[model samples]
Target: MASLIEDYALLSDLRTGALVSESGSVDWLCFPRFDSDAAFTALLGDSEHGRWLLAPEGAVDDCEPQHPARRSERRRAARAAGEEDPLQGEAEPDPAAEGRPVVVQRTYVDSTFVLRTLWKTPDGQALVTDFMPVGDRRASIVRRVEGLAGSVRMHQEISFRFGDGAVVPWVRRHEDQKSGDTSIVAVAGPDAVVLHGDRLPQGHDHRHIGDFIVSAGEAVDFELCWFPSHRHVPARIDAGASLQETVSYWKNWSKDIPQQESYHAVVKRSLLVLRALTHEATGGIVAAPTTSLPEDFCGERNWDYRFCWLRDAALTLEAMMTHGYEKEALNWRDWLLRAVAGDPDDLQIMYGVGGERRLPERNLDHLPGYEGSLPVRAGNGAVDQYQGDVVGEVLVALEKLRNMGGVEDHFSWPLQKKLLGYVEEHIDDKDHGIWEMRGDQKHFTHSRVMMWAAFDRGVRAVREHQLDGDAARWEELRDRLREEIMEHGYSEKEGTFTQTYDDAEVDASLLVIAQVGFIEYDDPKMLGTVARLERDLMDDAGLLLRYRTSSGKDGLSGAEHPFLACSFWLVEQYARSGRIDDARKLMDQLVGYSNGLGLLAEEYDTVDGRMAGNFPQAFSHLTLIRAADAINGHGQRAI
Candidate 1:
């Protein structure tokens, strides 16, 4: 089985990403683009489905008395030879099989996508550096292993199941025309991957396996490149040069991130995670890399998040814009215009990385889900749902970009006007809220608030910025929305805002009311809502849940853990309300929830003390950045 979700690190080429476990296994990866069929799908199944594992080769059972006896015998033999003693050398032990401690530590090489994992055993240490070459049209993943001390026997195994584990490729050995080195090529239909290294693994049982040893100071390099099967295999590039170029590219991009001294390290890493999830050419940022990692483990709540959600990407743009990344904002804005270019009536909640639509949700019966969260789904069905907050999110992000001195071009302003027109047409409709609930559509309070924000921004664009729009109508709707929400969305009996206009259920999303300028952070109504959320939705650890599953509002069975983003939103609210100590305390706890490499998932199982849901989620990280800014006195947003 694969390791826990938190035990993985991500490597990205700006188009796609590879999720590598701490023990050095590329268990999940989509080729060519973020929405492409996964070439390695072991994250959703066993190694036989698809995986690339490079781990130590032996058992290290310390409980065995024979180990001490053997060590003593080896020491005696060395002493008898009259030579200086050397440290005990053995193959790296498999922790699961050996019942021994195998400490695996990972971190990104500062401000870069290059990931380094060090495996330390009782006998020796080995370092595996993983990265994907950016600015290269050909999709490729590169891994280099180095021996730090003592000789360590390493096992390399690879299995390819193209098309999300639906197709097993025909594998064959071929000599590269340019380098004359033996490489293994796997071809299935139109997709193919060529594995090149100093010593390529030989095929066995429709798989590939290689065992090698690296003594102190020795190193080895491996590269996997993806291309169409019909096309000639891409010529190999210098791994050393690619490494340098990829590092330089990331460092240069990260140079502009403003420093937050207290949370500088985490802030920088969070920014990098967001960048890794973004498609360079399309500028669409995915919600997360691997999908079907359940929000409720062993439950059927798992949904594929590889496609780009406009709401998540828009919030990502706002986070970046706040931190001095306007170029990304403009790029994503352009992608948004192209993606929703047709009729405003046809705009989707999400799109493929290159702006392709028509993502039909279906089950992959062949591969088991992460932790047996069965019915592993792909292509989110949420695309068809009407999420009223989406245009609001986009408009809010563009407004922030404009605030940061971004000039609106002819295309962007026209797109905003069209979006406002769509809002006008859909004003009376009930639709799915920001959570993309599967339940029957209702006038979700959060969605209503966002619709208000949408018109607010639209009115501001015309009245404040001298842009083209019906300012009077937008202002009228904005005021009318506020009135509607105040009258129907809040409950005097409950002394707080309700989840929907028809019910009094408190939702974590209601925390954003203050964030969208709908109310003051310390407003008595917001305070009452916060109290209700804390009483009803907060876990034992002070973390916030999205809402009560017991309410059945989401139309789903099974309970979920607390959402990290919601907790961060609470922290932001606390900070802005002058609860500085409370904000800092909660911020510290939330930051501590990140994995060893400073990455967070969509949700966290505080009871299990592990990350849950999709790995390296953009929502979690983006909110983390905003929360940190708030705690550091930079998050005083004017309502």
Candidate 2:
């Protein structure tokens, strides 16, 4: 089984990424691009499907166990083992045997994304490090191995099962004339993979096997590149130079991030992970790199999030822009325009990385879901839902772009007008709201607030940026929205705004009403909503749940964990409202939820003390950046 979601770290080429466990197993990865078929699906299935592991070879023997249930047995075992190190063991075992130790430990080089894994053997140590060039457009993964101690034998395995490990490609080998080295190539359908390294393994059928001994100080490098299967052949490049370039690129990109005095290291690392999740060429940032990671064990609420949602991408861009990454913000704005172009009626709440539509949701019954969560789904069904807040998010991003002095092109102002016109026409229609609830639609208070924001920002664009738009009409609609929301959405008896006009339930998303400038942070109503959220929605650890699942509005069984982004929004609200001490307390607790690598997931189950949803979520990281910036006096900048 794979480790917990929080026990994994992220590595990417800025187009796609892989989730590597702390135990040095790359359990999930999409090749070539973010939306491409995954080559390693072990994160959602068994390891036999696909995975790349380089870790210490050991059996769980003796230790000062952390879990209370195992402590007594662990103590007894520790006394029996005396002083022996638990990790020392043999490398090879029966392939069909159970309880075998494979990959073991992983970490990144300080201030860089280069990941190193250590595998132990009875003889010595084997090390593998993986990294990618930060700003490069090409999709590349580089792996290097070294021997640190006594002579240790290592095994190399390669599998080319693509499309969630269902498509096995034809494999071939070619010898390089200049270097006298061989490289393996796998071609199937639209994808082709080329592997280059020293001492290339000999192949029989679709399998390859090799054994090499590495003494102290010995090093070897391996490089893999994916391309279109129709491409003639891949050219050779210097692996050493590629490694150096990748390191230099990441270091330079890391330097561009603004430094913070408090939680400096943690904040910088989260920022880098966020940058890695962004699509370099298209500027569409994925919500998370992998999908179908369940939010609750044995629950069927799993949905794919690899595609780009307008709201998530916009907020991600805002976070990056606020941290001095203006280029990413501009690129995302351009990508947004291209994605939402054409008939206003056809505008989707989410899109593929290249703005491709037709994202029909489907299930892969062949592969079991993470932790046995059934109905492993792909391609979000929420694409067709009417999310009223999407246009508001886009308008907010456009406003931020203009505020940052980004030049509005010929298509930008007209596109903004068209979107605003659509919002003007459909602002009253109650659809799915921001949560994409499959249940009945109601007048969600947060969605209404965002509608007001859309019109408000639209009017400001016309007035300040000198853009052409119906300024007077937008202003009137904005005021009307405010009036309607106050009339129906507010619950006087509860002293707070309700989730929707029909229900008096408090939602964590209500915290954003103040954060997004829909209302003053210190306003009595906003303060009341904040207090209600803290009392009703927050778990014991101070993390905020998405909503009261007991209300049965989400159309799913079994409650989900607290959403980290919502918690961060609360932190921002508290800080902006002059509750600095409360804000700092919550901030510390939220930041402490990060894994040892300083990466966060989509949600954290406070009661169970486990991470839920997808790993290295962009929303969580963006909110962390936003909250940190607010507490640091940077304030929320328009992006």
Which one wins on lDDT? 1
TM-score of every prediction relative to native: 0.93, 0.90
Residue-level lDDT of model 2, residues 529-585, one tens digit each, is 998988999887778888988999988788788889998998888878888788888
Alpha carbon lDDT of residue 389, candidate 2? 82
Clashing pairs for predicted structure model 2, backbone only: 55-104, 55-119, 56-120
lDDT by residue (324-384, candidate 1, tens digit) is 8889988998899899998999988999888988999999999877767888988888999
What is the number of residue pairs that collide in model 1? Answer: 0
lDDT of each: 0.86, 0.78
Clashing pairs in 1: none
| Candidate number of the best TM-score | 1
